[model samples]
Target: MKPVSTWAAMLSLSLAMAGCVTINIYFPAAAAEKAADRIIDEVWQLKPDAATKEGAPSR
Candidate 1:
């Protein structure tokens, strides 16, 4: 019974320590900015609806 309790305590302690790990991730700002600009340009290049061509008010 004592051995089981000791084992349980160690496992809980190990799990608690495991939860404290830190992960560092780095993002490349230049690459992200380039990708965002490309997406924005593609979106802006799309043609407007036909209603707008006739001078109708766009919703």
Candidate 2:
């Protein structure tokens, strides 16, 4: 009886521990940096006269 209870406790503990695992995924730093730079450049490339030209009312 005691052995059975001990085995049950250990099995339950192992299962609980198994559910607590973590997996880490990594991104390549250089590629990520380059992508970020490209995005920043595109965001900053808006033409200064775009609003005036595009917002003018047409007859």
Candidate 3:
């Protein structure tokens, strides 16, 4: 009984420490493009929709 309770306490402490850990991640992004006049055609794997073509309004 003592060993089982001690093991549970240790496991809970380890889990609490892990949950308190902080991780930081950074991603590079384009803030501004040289051709600001041009419309954005794509982002990542996304492409422009036919209804959202440049110089035309969406239906």
Candidate 4:
């Protein structure tokens, strides 16, 4: 009974510590979107077939 109670207490303490950590990350979503657009434009220029055609039959 003592071992089981001790194990339960230890488990509860570790679970409490899991939420105490801090993470900081910074990313420029606008800059990333601009870069992605440029890449897609370049790829589309290289392969015009990749562009979706207007008035095409929908799948």
Residue-wise lDDT of candidate 4 within 1-59, one digit each (tens)?
44568888999999899989889887799998999999998877864443446544545
TM-score of 2: 0.51
Q: Estimate each model's TM-score.
A: 0.59, 0.51, 0.41, 0.40
Error of 3 at 3 (Å): 10
lDDT of 1 by residue, 1-59 (tens): 34568888999999999999999998799999999999999988878885599899998
Strongest candidate by TM-score: 1
Highest lDDT: which candidate?
A: 1
Q: Report the lDDT tens digits of candidate 3 across residue range 1-59.
A: 44568888999999999999999976444534534324454433365574376556865
Query: After superposition, which runs of candidate 4 have C-alpha atoms over 4 Å from their true positions?
Result: 1-4, 19-24, 49-59
RMSD of 3: 7.6
Ranking of models by TM-score: 1, 2, 3, 4
Sort the candidates on lDDT, descending order.
1, 2, 4, 3
What is the alpha-carbon lDDT for the whole of candidate 3? 0.65
Give every collision pair in model 3: none
Poorest stretch of ten by lDDT in candidate 1: 1-10
The digit string of per-residue lDDT tens for model 2 on 1-59 reads 34568888999999999999989999999999999999999989998777679986645
Q: Model 2: clashing residue pairs?
A: none
Q: Which parts of model 2 have CA positions greater than 4 angstroms off?
A: 1-15, 51-59
Model 4 has an lDDT value of 0.78
